[model samples]
Target: MSTVIEIDRLSKSYVVPVRGAGVRASIVSLVKRKTRTVEAVKEISLSVEAGEVVGFLGPNGAGKTTTLKMLSGLLHPTGGTASVLGFEPWKRNNDFLRQITLVMGQRNQLIWDIPVIDSFDRNRVIYRLTREEYRERLDELVELLELGELLSKPVRNLSLGERMKCEVAAALLHHPRILFLDEPTLGLDVSMQRRLRTFVEQYNKRTGATVLLTSHYMADVEALCPRVVVIHHGELLFDGKLADLVRKFSAQKTLVLELEESQEDLSRFGQVVSQEGSRATLRVPKQDTAEVTARILRELKVQDLNVADPPIDEIIDQVFSRGMA
Candidate 1:
């Protein structure tokens, strides 16, 4: 596959004034301003292939959003080189802008007090889409998004979930070749979040658009993206499959046992994580998982037992902690 996104030694920094809290420092700062340089993104490089869906993950204060902004042509990078769809993103050329679409959850592009379809029509004009192309794409998206009735209602009158659905449709009307989704499922109900994830998967398959999705919700990453790029302190940490990340940093597995009765001691098997009614959970070392499972089944009246790897969230937390440490 061709390289849709290529970043080389990309970096960004900011200069801000700093001063003491008290009156003396405040007065001194007025005369002699003290400024400090803050590095929001350090030199980081990665290549994304065409039609690939990759997750961009990082803790708060990391450079996830900053890197995305630079890629989407929304912000100028302080240093380094980057390109998307064979065009320099920071240049903000019309040809480049027409091929890329960015959807930010907190920021709305649709006008209030207008029907959702009208907003979509406005986007059609902005993208200079022909009438037939606009109609075809609109009908396809509305059916896939199940926005038949919602499109007729005013955007201001619709619920948050409804409005977000419209926002996604508006962004896709131009059929952008690349998609930058920053927390697209933020603040949505669980069902709505799942629905959006499904929509992303379908859109990618149907359009073959390269996508870089940054979401705090693991469900979104697990369902849509097989590869992930993790950043911390404005630096790259891991760039690979999610399972590889968990296996590399996580040294323990969880063992869940269904006991025949409650109040039975199972600490001898492993470190008990939780116990409720007839179920008990234990954490055991990866190498000793098989031995511990055998011992539990051999030594106790176990109704059922299962062994699984650590949760993705726990593995990611460890990745950040170790990287920051």
Candidate 2:
């Protein structure tokens, strides 16, 4: 695959005025204003190949949305550079804008009072798609996203999940080759989240579009992205396969053991996470997993045993806690 998105030392910063609380100090600050520079995104470099779905991982205010905005041409960077499909993103070229779509979870692009289909048609017009091309793509999206029933309803009448589905469909009507999804599944219930994930997977497989997604929900990342790039404190910390991230940052391993009896105290071996009937889940240090497993089996009769990495959420928390180490 070819490199569809490339950035070298890409950075974005903001300078905000600072003021004192008291009236005298505030009045003095009018003449001599104090300001601080906040680096939303530091010198971070990354390359994304065509047809790849990459999870852009970071916590709240950790520059995930800022980076996405820069890549989608919504914001100009303070320093460094980025190229998307051979066009500088900050330049906002017509060709570049038509070839990419950004879907933000907390924001809405559709007209609130209009029917969902109207908003989709507006996007079709903006992208200047031929009638036949628009119809074809719209039909595909309606079918895949199951947007048929919700299309005629006004945006105000639809539920949050329904509106989100339409928002995604609207964004894709132009057949953008690059998708920048920032928390696409935010505020969605479990089933709705799953449906959206499935649609994203199918869309990528069918169109071979490149996707960069940022979500707090790990399930979204696990379901759609094979590779992940982690950023924290406006810095790039790790970039590779999701499995490798688990192996690198996870200091503890989980052991699920089905014991012959439920009464045994397993705290001697490891931290017992939960116990129900004969099933117990334990968390042990990664380095002593083997020793803990042996001790558990030798001391207590075990019927079944399985060892796995700590949950992705835990690993991510660990990564944020120990930033840049």
| Candidate 2's TM-score | 0.97
What's the lDDT of the predicted structure labeled candidate 1? 0.91
lDDT of each: 0.91, 0.94
> For model 2, which pairs clash?
none
lDDT of 1 by residue, 247-291 (tens): 888889999989887898888888999999899999999999999
lDDT (C-alpha) at residue 220 in model 2:
97
**Top of the candidates by lDDT:** 2
Residue 91 in model 2: lDDT: 93
Off by over 4 Å in 1: none
